[model samples]
Target: MTIRPIVRYPDPRLALPAQPVTVFDGALRELASDLLETMHAAPGIGITAPHIGISLRVVVLDLDPVDGARTYVNPEIIWASPEMILHQEGSVSMPGVNDDIRRHARVRIGYRDIDGNAQTEESGGLRAVCHQHEIDQLNGVFWIQRLSRLKRERLVKRFEKLSRG
Candidate 1:
């Protein structure tokens, strides 16, 4: 597996909605592998396909230190609780910026495995927030979108300055 370059913020592709995966085959598997490698290289717990410019409903997560990687194809949040929790979240695509965002404390997600088998899992805490964050990227939503208007403007200005440099 090769580490793919993450498409940074302000990249149009990061804001564009990804296409659904119609054909689940070797290419998709390779994409998952590459995503894992990229996530590991970034030292991040989660990654979405759109972050790498693939624009597909795919994500890789490895929140556990011992367990193997978790690959999700066409992941969808099935259920979310009303109870909200604030977590300081960061993204590989947007380095050096962390935002405290409110998200569902618990969520049930459904998605397809690498073998084309359907799977559902319940998660909470950092895992839940990370999963939801990455899934949002699959739909072209960034964590900055969850921030207040002033914070969003500040982040955009920071990113703009970084780009200028």
Candidate 2:
């Protein structure tokens, strides 16, 4: 697996919705592998295809590098618990910029495995936050959208400042 370059924030591709994965084949598996390598290299717990400019409905996540990674194709959140929690969130695409964001404490999600099998699972804590965050990216919704207007504005300004430097 090769580590692919992650598209940084302000890239138009990161704001676009990803296309669904139709064929589950060797290439799909390779992409998943590459995604895992890339996400690990980013030192991030979660990453989506759009973050790397692939524009496919794929996500790879592994909170602990020693535990292996998970690939999600066409992932969709099926249910979310009423309880919410705030977690500090950052993006590989927008490194060095992060803010506490509110997310469902627990979530049930449906997705396709690399072998073309349909899979469903529930997750909580950082895993839940990661899924919700990556799913939002698949839908072209960046995490900062969950923030209030003031925070969003501040983040954008900071990104702009970084670009200038």
Candidate 3:
């Protein structure tokens, strides 16, 4: 598996909605493997296919090193708890910036595994936050888009300065 360069923010492809994965074959497995490797290298908890310029609805999350990684293809949020929680979120695409974004404290998502098995799972806490964050990217919703206008502008400026340095 190889680590693909993560597309930085402002990349047009990052804003475009990802297409669903049509076939679950060896190639899909390989892509998933590569994405996992990339995510680990980024030292991030989750990553989406579009993070590496692949516009497919794929997400990998490895919240705990001991628990192994999980992949979700064509994931869709089926249900979200009414209660919202504020969690600090960031993207590999836009590093060096983080802010508390409000999201559902718990979520249920439906998707297929790499084996093409349909699955639905509910998650809470950091796991839930990570899933929501990555799933947003799959739906063309960048993390910063969840922030207020002023916060978004400040994040942009902060990212600019970090990149320059």
Candidate 4:
């Protein structure tokens, strides 16, 4: 698997919604593998196909080495808890910047596996936040959009400064 180049912040493609993966073939498996390599190279916990400009609703997450990596195809949040928690969030596309974001403390996600088998998983804590975050990305919502205007602006400025250096 190759570590594909990530589309950086402010790229118009990053703002656009990703298309759903239809054919579960070798190409889809290759894309998921590439996404895993790219996410690992980015040193991030999670990443989506959009992060590499593929525009497919594919997500690869490796929250912990012990649990191993997971590939989610066309993932969507099936349920979310009313209780919320503030957790630090960031994106592989926008490196070096993160902020506290409010997200559901627990979530149930419905997605397909690499082999196109339908599956569902319930999670809490960081995994729950990751599910919400990556699904939002597939829906064309950047993580910073969840922040207040002032906070988003400030974080963008910092990211810009970091990009420059």
TM-score of candidate 3 to 2 decimals? 0.98
lDDT of 3 by residue, 45-155 (tens): 899999999999999999877989999999999999999999999989998889999999999999999998999999999988988999999989999999999999999
Query: Which structure among the candidates has the greatest lDDT?
Result: 4
Clashing pairs in 2: none
Give a tens-digit lDDT track for model 2, residues 46-84: 888898889899999987658688899999999999999
Worst 10 residues of 1 by lDDT: 156-165
lDDT of 4 by residue, 55-165 (tens): 899999898879899999999999999999999999999999999999999999999999999999999999999999999999999999999999999999999999999
Residue 55's lDDT in candidate 1: 79
Residues 1-165, model 1: lDDT tens digits: 899888988788888778877888998899999999999998788899988888799999998878778998888999999999999988889877787999999999999998888899999998899889988888888889999999989987887777677
- Give the clash total for candidate 1: 0
Off by over 4 Å in 3: none
- The C-alpha stretches of model 4 lying farther than 4 A from their native spots are none
- After TM-score superposition, what is the CA distance of residue 4 in candidate 4 from its true location, in Å? 0.5
Model 1 C-alpha RMSD to native: 1.4
After superposing all C-alphas onto the true structure, candidate 3 shows an RMSD in angstroms of: 0.7
How would you order the candidates by lDDT, starting with the best? 4, 3, 2, 1
